[model samples]
Target: MASMLISLSHFCDKHGPRILLVTQAAINGSTGDELLVPTYPTDSYCESCLLHFPKSSINDIRSLKSNIGSQCFVSTQYSSIRYQLLTLIIRRSFSEETMIYDGMPLVFYDDIRGLNLVMGFKLNDENARGNERRYCIIFTIDSTDHTSSMQLLSENWNFITGGFDRMVKYICNSHKQELERQNNVNDEKSNFNLLGKTYLRGNKVKVPRNLAELTHDELLFVRLHKWNSFLLNSCMRSSSE
Candidate 1:
């Protein structure tokens, strides 16, 4: 038996380095006719050996029920479902580890064979204050693919996909909240600019204008200029009198 670990980062830059380890059992001393093992490795592909035999000489490997552990592996019949699950798992794992301080985004995609998972997390200028988080997406064939008994496994895989989708949504919402907070801060700074600087009763700085008047950048700038002139003229008049 042999395993192969393939890194997705080599193929795609958007998806950071993702590892998929494939372990297969060699059949009848032939390398090409190897049976794909059900275990998910941190690598993408792990082959038993490089020795290739004639296709006619190789025999098909029997399938078996999958007994994957509770780790972050995903089981799916549909390639799309598998791709989505793997992407979500990687994103969830990354989010758990790092604090998201910026609005940089992460992207994920499965390889053309649908056997490899790719994940990329990049920090934009907006998120430069945060840590550079890396993401890994992984994919493996459903264990049932090798066996005759696939009905139960297929159903279970579907259920898992549903649960995974819900989790992904939650993560997305968290990112959204971060963006909303950033926007709120920007709005506050903008409002400060629009309200001709005024002093509150407590000596705290205040904006003379309301949010409605300062809602748009264009309107805010115009209002700011008008308010500035008004304040200057009033001060001058009081001093002269």
Candidate 2:
């Protein structure tokens, strides 16, 4: 089981899914709805794997085998209307929309790739709007050893899906925390007073009572200069000692 899992991980590193995003865009002076776009693989290993399959887009690579091929130029637009429609059909057939809404991922046999598997699912984000709101993952598996690979994947389905769920939660929580931090910073900026006691980068600084009044920028410069001088003096004393 462990060896199978490791091989499966390595397989995924090569053929993992690239996100098929849908976002609003302006086209010919009109607003377009759910404009589909492809993204680079989120994993560094998967990105490195791209160096192997140069003629193939993430979607088109299902036609390619498990082995790495020589680098070749690719002119086909993976995000073209036809490919988009094909992906849409694949999603619908795989019940990808249902999976997104119901919070369950679907793994099914590839319609075209024979004996290979396809997994489709979405990550929910409360802050997203329209089609941009759906963080979808759809990938097809191509393995040299299909029998053992299929068995391992089928048996460990629950664990695989749970890991994906946890990953989504971690990402969402991190984003929420960052937004909260930005909000706190803005609130501090709004509440700050400029005319009262001396402040250097939001910290109070003591100045001589007899010293001339200084503008905010001038005061900041003075404080910075004082810090530099103190550091220099400390360094000099340490060197002497």
Candidate 3:
């Protein structure tokens, strides 16, 4: 037990914030592959692997749940992503395990597909089998397809017809340690483009900083701008195809 505790302490100290484990089946084929980014490595496709996000991203994690037009007090648009982003605090470069050590929150984006068959008798339109593509967000505490710890973050009709598939990620023992490491290096240096990637300034690097460089409003604006850009870019690319 003593040795086990030491090992865990080392792991936590070495890798701040828990890791996000994604299933390889979720990333099958081309559609699933595109969801991957630089931080999300695919060395272990069949088995669960870690997902990374900068702790600074928590600035934009200010998501609120809404149930407008929801059938069961859930949600209507299916595009609401409030629940996917958590309120939990993830500190960068923590020496001890924080809230992220016990139950880490993760964010993932993907598409849930299902075949729907319409009755042959109904020929007055809406009778054909509709496309099965849907934008979805699934986050769970454990590494499994279905679990009591699982929560459906978001889902919306894929009107653009782009192929997307399963994506799972959350904070856990597996959360990326490198993100925190890089964040610290950048903070000390105050220079972007560390580790071959651009470190967003202003609100883009919204994580809690010891230096108190940026204000809350500035960070919020940066977060909103980023999300908007990402959403718009995705739609444009898919629509043009």
Best by lDDT: 2
* TM-score for each candidate, following the candidate numbering: 0.29, 0.35, 0.16
Superposition TM-score, candidate 2 onto the true structure: 0.35
Clash number for every model?
22, 0, 7
> Candidate 1 residues 1-241, lDDT tens each?
1111111111122333232222221222243222333423324321211111112345522221121221112111112323444444444435444423232223222332222222333322232123222323222332323331133224333332333233234334544565577679877876776685843232233212211111222232122223322322232233234
What's the candidate order when arranged by decreasing TM-score? 2, 1, 3
* Candidate 1 lDDT score relative to the true structure: 0.29
Task: Give Cα distance to truth, residue 76, candidate 1, Å.
Answer: 22
Sort by lDDT, best first: what order? 2, 1, 3
RMSD of 2: 22.8
What C-alpha root-mean-square deviation, in Å, does candidate 3 show against the real structure? 21.8
| Candidate 2 colliding pairs, count | 0
TM-score of 1: 0.29
Best by TM-score: 2
lDDT against the true structure, per candidate, is 0.29, 0.31, 0.22
